[model samples]
Target: MSMSGEDDGPADSGLAPEGVTNDLVELLFFAYRDFVGDPDRMLAEYGFGRAHHRVLHFVYHYPGLTIAELLDILRITKQSLNRVLKDLIEQGHIVQKTGRSDRRQRLLYCSETGATLTAELTRVQVRRVARAIADPVADEPKGARDEHGFAAAQGFLMAMIEPEERAAVRSLMARRARSRR
Candidate 1:
């Protein structure tokens, strides 16, 4: 809102001046709220939080993720991550191995216990996503679906990232995808 009591967006900014973006912004917030609600509760039972879930999910997906790379991917300070990393390591949910070529590098991997927990958390979320994407109703979003009704959700998420980081994210995901195959 401007000082003139109007809700117009900034001058010279090509954004919707009539505040049309607020609806999507609010929806994103609400969607995220419900999306993480279950996981948040599950983590709390283990005395954990979103930080643990994020680290667990990434390390599970990207085995051999280094401390520095995880830091960059999470955009978190070492001090913040240290607490979570230490807890995860101490709980036997994650393990750090010396990088094969670079002995000084600490590569992260999830333990079997961590994998089980991650699977449970992911199962809950995947069910929610599947329900939302299954074209269940007449008013459901269809454009988000690609040909054969898949893959484009990933594209939409990739498009939402910062332009400069998109390439790096793509590279990271590509490496993970290859490993899975």
Candidate 2:
């Protein structure tokens, strides 16, 4: 059970006996904080918060997302989501339409202003991620690490999610992509 040996077991391989990797846990925490920080500040300027940002981001990306679908995606209580939804609707940042077949369903869509603001907020985040992925290649050849970095990052992020949820997430992404076209 030598910690310094190349043949270290799971207990000595930088993970706790419970199989938790402290370094990864901390990295995820820090990464999420910074990733959402940019949008949080931007949302504050509009008298909104992270909740509003999340709603706007999702609705903007997935127009026509139903209230139930949004609730599922955000995993927030109805009351909590209602407050944010009310503000966004009253402020004219979002529009909710009754579903054609399901009259009880409220489909969400971002207004022009909302889209503009969401884009601006998202641009900062996209830039931050782009820099992060490209940083590894700063001293390397142009194409040497770009694809590898992107694929690795994507794969790592996907792997972090629960196995059962991965297919649903991918399906949602694919549906959104198809709708964008």
Candidate 3:
């Protein structure tokens, strides 16, 4: 049978075969899993999960994120975030300070212990990324960049995120700026 529309068949269009998106989806899942493998094992040893890692990572990046801001960054409910923050604070990995102007507002900062933990976690992630780029099995093919394959994949990933989530992320960034003072 002859196809009348682009979506009806891949043979008459530029798009990949019907199942091509699945190939990309699976690749992303496995690739991300392997990407975080080293860090995941290390965090497990410390009784931390990915949620803890994400909190530590962003806190380390922003330096003075508030509870509201952290909630946005993690896309988690306030209650869930409080659980993680409480553990971190009790472990001496993070310190919360009351805002100078708005004493009711609490600002979160990493303690010396927190800084060390963040450093160790970052190293694990960096090494994993470096190894992936250097591995014979996973290294970019000879012409990957020239063919724009890597850029396309990155763009696709960004495009997949919902608009609302992006707005929340931007709001968190604004909170970080306001807290800097």
Candidate 4:
């Protein structure tokens, strides 16, 4: 509802109706926290953290991704990355190959063990997602229409993000989609 004392014109154009934004923000936070919960537990069992899970997930998706690419995708400092990479490499979960084009460059690949673990993590996540979508108790409509609506909302959210950020996000999503096939 518009404020009675205020002349609401372009001032409110960029803002979501008062309570809506807060409610959506809260929902997003809780949803993401729950989304990561299972994986965090699994990672903890393997002596890994979210950072390690992220590195493993991407390397498993894009085998032979360069360190520079991983750094860009992660947006973390080299020191932090190095610590995680060292642990992963020592655990025999990932292998670093000398770049063919640049011998000084290190390219990361998930080892067979890493691939297996990654697959397990992904399976767990997908199963959880499928269950959430399929649950009748959730009051969500059952079928393709519901899935399509979810996809549409995802696209809308992506569109609201900055273009350059979108490009990286799209690349990552496309890579994952292709890998799943």
Count of clashing residue pairs in every prediction: 0, 0, 0, 0
* lDDT score, candidate 4, position 42: 93
Off by over 4 Å in 1: 1-20, 136-181
How do all the candidates rank in terms of lDDT, highest first?
1, 2, 4, 3
Give per-residue CA lDDT, model 3, range 1-181, as digits (tens).
5475547364655454434344356446555665566567878988988788888888887887888888887889998988888888899988889988888888888899888989898987776555544432322234443242543553333233332343553354456546656
lDDT of each: 0.72, 0.72, 0.67, 0.70
Compute the lDDT for candidate 1.
0.72
lDDT of 4: 0.70
Candidate 4: misplaced stretches above 4 Å?
1-15, 130-181
1 against 4, candidate with superior lDDT: 1
Give a tens-digit lDDT track for model 4, residues 5-24: 65433235543343333333
lDDT of 1 by residue, 59-161 (tens): 9889999999999999999999999999999999999999999999999999999999998998988776666555232222456423432234343333333
Clashes of 1: 0
lDDT of 2 by residue, 66-179 (tens): 988999999999999999999999999999999999999989999999999999998987876766655421222244534324434444444444345556655655565576
